[model samples]
Target chain A: MSAALRLHRADTQPPADLAGEFLARLDRRLHLPQPHRRQVLDELACHLDERVRDLMVTGVTEEQATRRAVEELGDPMVLARRFERAHVAPRRRRIMNMLMVGLASAAALTGAMTLRAPQVTIRSAVYPPPDAVQQVPQKPLDVQGLPPDVQWGDFFSLAASTSGKSPVVHWGALRELDSDNFGPGHSLGIDPLVDQKLTLDQFLELINTEKGFVADNRIEYREEEGRLVFATTHYFDRRETRLVTYDVSELLRARLGGDADNPDRVPGAVHEIADLIRALVESGMWDVNGGSASITTYGTKLFVRVPQRLLPRIEWVLEQAADAHIGAHQGASVDRRQGDPLHTPRDGAALPPAAGSSTVVSVQLQRVDPAAARQILNQAFDGVPSLKQCSVARWITVDASSRTVSVSATQRHAEFVGRLLTMLDRPGADVVASAESSMQVIPLARVSSETMDSLIRAIAGGSTLYGREFRLVANPQQNSVIVEGPTGVVTALQELIALLDTDWEEPAKVGAAIGR
Target chain B: MLHKDAQRDQAELVILSLLDAQGPLYGYAISKEVSGRSDGQLRLTPGVLYPLLKELESEGLISGSVEEVHSDRKEAAPDAAEGRKRKWYRLTARGRKRLAARIEAHRTWRRVIDLFIARDPMDHDQKEHGR
Candidate 1:
């Protein structure tokens, strides 16, 4: 017999009744398998024995040592309850094992189907009402009898047909312009010559020449931030640039997995943001001069050119977006006067006097302009709920002339003073903005080659992007797995692998948490 | 002062750090080391330590195996037979990396907090008065 069995059978001095009682209670409460249950009890017994020996060495009696040891281990019922919650019952595992095997392949096909189905239905819903659509005037051209140098007024028109007759090109209004008059319906007088077919590019060139605005329209297909991005830049003002970037990485990864029918199609959420931007522009909300924006899958960050007069509308829109639970951040300004130092806040004058004399704080932000300094103060105060409750705007004054922000409040508001000073000294935007794409190769220890291969198969079967976006290569030389992909996906995969390697880990929890 | 939840969260880090510093150790040794290192400020009961040990073992961060204690190798305990077996746990490569990451995060947090604490307003006010 083993030493553990011999000790149990010997039964000397009633075997510490406190420990025996605790073990009996734990054994009854525990839901672990028979082998695991025995192991746990033996470990607990060993721990108790060690504690008792240590305590007795310190001059404690046998009974006293046993009692103290049992007490230090804590209530057996609580430990048992925690262990029960942590253990995965064998029956539950059996059921999950069966379900995963059947659903693995089906999930891949269904996941792909669901991804491509709703996009078409959601496209129309993304557009604004009919009234919001800008209207362009339409005119037909007559080619039978016409003077060579005819005066075409506000609208450009040409008569053309695909049949073997002289194709007269008729130019219709491209799009309606609500405010800037930059959209369409501007005049383009052409020099009349022998009537021939004119290509679309030729017509666009003519319009570009006639209009002072440079028609810098460009479309690009590229990958950004782990998602495929199709960008179209329409330049209305040479001084301003607008980036209405949409993050559809998640939506794409979710929908276009496992033999998706149309993997190249754009996601619905991207289309929605594009449509919203167009509606906003038509509604005369594109009042800023030079601006750009990045609308991510979950967050929206915008940089708007706000004239002094249009600040109220921008504030109102921001408030509305906040109420809707939309993540929006106000980025750089597009004011031409401040264009010399791009991305930095505009400078301000000297500091103003405080309202109260109880406390006075004057902070100088070295390189930042007054307007930007004020914005930074507002955002910092807004970040902390307690400071935001009292409203930082009421007590603090920003001075552009001396480049100093003075805060005067009562003695009780000294906390605000401390927080504001810390903000001035905290890390700048440059430190916060640097994010590098990380690539790592983690060696799998004690995990069999077959298990790793099975994992690779499951992932590739579930997600269609396995070969393209995300690549998992097994390096036998290093006895490790090299996962190379976008930082987010690779990190997620690494976490999943760690979870899988855990012996007592709940496979269901790991499966459910992983997107694939 | 750490709350119960905060202490529980730091349990994994403490265990991994101990394993990295002292090599393989059993459950009781790990618990005792934690209490001793914290100068009795952080006391980990069996209820907390055992569950955390099991979790870390399951997470692939640490590997555990049973080691037999023979009379020839070390002093045999008086209570039981000559030979006894105890499970000992050692940190895997992943466990070491995890410990390093958590330590780095704690260091960064401490640095930020120190910056705020060091910039005492009263000191600034006194300096202005002196000027």
Candidate 2:
């Protein structure tokens, strides 16, 4: 009789004592209702019996086969755990469901409260009053009699409460006036104005002078409607002009012709350089051109009387000229004298050595647009110390009308920009000469020709900006694409087509199909 | 080594596909068929197979029916008490649809991975040099 038949006949009787014990252990751990437990045990018993029968057919004795089959079934506890995981909801999941419901209830309650409390303003408790207020007449307080060591807050509060004229503290203007005056943790105490006894007007003046708040008449006591009113001034009312002396002796020496030793040439070179400065700098700001800015020469120096904002631009132009002249005459030794100290337009800090020195060069782009070239050069030179010290965009001018980029940068920066521009401005003739155009017919095996055609068109069209000329035609009849383009683009397309034209296969089909 | 979770998911797909191909099969028969087909390289031990089968059946992807195995002896009646019963499992209609979706998803995932693998590193270096 077949082993399976023999096993079935044996199953009609009670199972072997060992098999029965294994089943009982599994049944105990199953933790199911009687009907369900019986069903699972029956299924496991049938599986064990069949396994024993198969093993017996392979020349194993019945007792050994039964033991082997039981051993292969694995630990009953582990099997029970697996069965429990499949059949029952885990404790963690049940807790998570309860937590989710709790959160939903809280959210719903909050939403209902929001709908009911629509009129709530929710304003901050510590709202700051407006920094500036209209001047109002109030009785004067004898601030001079106050103690010298009084705290600033108490002093201001005493003055405001007694005189009924609260001092309008322009905090932003104060920070701009002198950031160092208010040191760390000194916001409530005016450190510089401490330990001083003066009249109210004199005290305000001391605060203004000691803190360097006198610039642009920012802080002052003015008599209006027969009352002394303290106010901080605004620059928007009028533009301030300042006289700055730039020592361009090095630049004047470089501009001198063959008659370098002539005394007459010195004045002429100075005037010429001065005129060039006036022409190169912002025209609208120059005084001679109906603007506030004016330029004149004194020996080898250029005295420029312009608005405070125009100082940096004039300095940038002179520095560029000096750099170019010095670069042209390698052996030239020109004297560089420090100019008078001037406040930087940005933060009014003392100016550093003419922020940046650059050589001026005009490039006529053959292919790249001037605007695009400027963008690329800006990105390349971003975060450069010299570029960051001064404004990069100010030194680089793009003339889209003439397709020219005029760059005033240091020699190293100039060279980098030139090389980058050369790479970017790839003319059709240059590309053809360097890497000749080629024709490629790539067959589509996986993707449709129409799909690849559209994809190649989208990809290759973007490459045209790099001076890569290409034409693509999809041959639907043969399921192929014909490409005629620069060798690099064609080769790239070929690589892309080869990669994309592939059959999709499962990761480990053979191994997975082998089953384990 | 495959993670336990990933191995379990792969086993689910394999089992579903097997049932679709082989029709109704008892637990032991299914295990034997898998072992034989894979040349003993894959062994679906009872502990793994029974739990996965139960889970699949609970999910409604597969349905099971109990069948009685009568003795082959001529004297045995069809309704005889001398018979051992076994549960047979077969793929439901939902199971077939799920198998098809899983296969498509696996192919798409493999295609994406192959795209990255097929890229030539030397070509990428050359392109970078050209730039």
Candidate 3:
């Protein structure tokens, strides 16, 4: 007989009641098999032996000491239950919940297709962007002319089919002289600034030659936080003297102390701003196109060419100069400008205030602008409820501040809370069905892998999320696996909110209270 | 000759005795069917107050779990922790079934001697002890 069995041979087995409870708990916590549960107990026999030795020190017989040690430890069932309850706290539930919601929302908008790629180190592995090729595809193609359904690529929330003809590229828009005339048209170009020093006349003509680069046309300006935003439909043609024209708002914004509602009236100021930009580019005082600039006005009427790129070489040097005296920023005559509306119409008609308008909360799924970031939660969630309605926005923010990845949820009611009671039982990557009716936060484990895939795909296929570039990723991120892909600010922020919500979890009552 | 209450007074002792002599006792096998032999006076509750057994164990006395069960639920779980969960608790090599069984042994003797008195023992007590 084995030494272990032989040693246990003299001992009577535990009652089925005690044994059964111990086995069940081991399975749930360690994901061990029943036979495996026996091993755990077997391993504890050594602990039992040491405990018996301690009892023996008190002069008890060896057998009596061991028996006393095992007895004092209590039934294995009670111990198992105690360990399980202690190891898993409620906080982990919150993390998992947030991860699910954030991922779900991204999935909903991104065709719910999980993309997997090896973890590519940002510093070590670099690939030129997919569309970085200089040579363009077949041109003069009309994409909209084709049937609307011929879709390719995996951005489910948004779809695109460009006519090999004129490209309708518009990620950013600026300058609306007349909202009526300014439909949703966007024009951009990427001609590097200096070919050779030219008089003021040459610069104007260089910009005019490019498609839609003229003064009356609209051009995009950078946000307060400057991001390197590459635009489409813009091409560069290297020519004699290489003339390039870009919006000079960044450079001019600096000239005007940050805000230039208008920039045309101050004639002499315009000339000076233009001259300064010319000098900076010619002297190579700025990085090749890195002095970062935008088109702006000196004041209400003084048009000033400006650089908007963060950390421009030119701006740094200028600041260092003892006499950083450039031209004086002057107040020009005013020209009243039209302003955009407080709330743009959605669903074609302006959205009427529904009942419980005060309770109508909007959470941002994607950032429209800073002001929109603070929009009503209901309005924000109007189209993207898969994420925001559970309202983990605040919760998600809080968690990220405290921990790295956390397992959490935003359950609304108690019955819904039952969905999670079983999570302790599930092992491996699971898409647990969490909740069906947004009314109660009843969570269910994934009906199956296939079911989860279809659900995610169905939701994701319908959304028009932004910045979904195709790349490979690690396993939890692949088909039917949990994955995290690089997302644009709009999607990233939503995820951040989802992360924040899951930490300190709530029961289903939260949703019920609000829904009621 | 055995005293009338020899076995009844120390049931835990008798159980520990049975377990000590014969490796272990399942819940059903312990403390029963031997009742008639115990002068028809000894009775053990399987369903109620089983807690006494556990209380005895808390003091480092006796212990068990239903390990080594043959049921389908038991066979599937291959881990020993699981099997031990199925296996019942038995005495370690050092336990005397009664930690210091001498104490329980004396209590049994006292109870057995007491059984000698008549039911309305006022007559016997004055008669026996007064002598």
Best by TM-score: 1
Give lDDT tens digits, candidate 3, residues A1-516: 122332222245433323333334333434234553454444344334344455667998655664564555454434443333222322332223224333434433445342443221111111221223233222222323323332211111111222122223233332232233223332212123323343223332433332224332323211112221112212110000121232333334445443433534233334444434433332222232243233333332222223222124333322322122333222221111322111111321222222221111112222233232222222333333233444422321111221211112222221121122111112212222221111001121112222232333332332222323211111111112232333332233232222222211122234444452
Badly placed stretches (over 4 Å) of model 2 are A1-15, A89-516, B71-82, B116-131
- lDDT for residue A138 in candidate 3, whole number 0-100: 21
List model 2 lDDT by residue over A1-516, tens digit each: 112223222433333545666776676566666765666777886777677777879997767877888898887756775675555533322223222222233333343222222221211111122124444344454555545544544555555555554454444544555565432234432332334444565666555543434344455443333333333454321223566666665554555545555775566556555655655555434565466567777765666666554556666656565544333322122112322111112321221221344345556787777887777655433423222333335556676776766655444444334444544564545445545554555655444455566544443343352456665666543456766566766665675555434321111121133231
lDDT of 1: 0.46
RMSD of each: 32.8, 32.5, 35.7
Provide TM-scores for the models: 0.36, 0.31, 0.18
Error in Å for residue A345 of model 3:
19
Q: Which residue runs does candidate 1 get wrong by more than 4 Å?
A: A1-15, A88-516, B1-5, B70-84, B115-131
- DockQ-wise, the better of 1 and 2 is 2
lDDT per residue for candidate 1 within A315-397, as digits (tens), equals 33333322331122111111224212112124322233334334455556565565665665565345433334444455567
Task: Give the fraction of reference interface contacts each candidate recovers.
Answer: 0.21, 0.36, 0.01
Number of backbone clashes in candidate 3: 135
Least accurate 10 contiguous residues by lDDT in model 3 chain A: A233-242
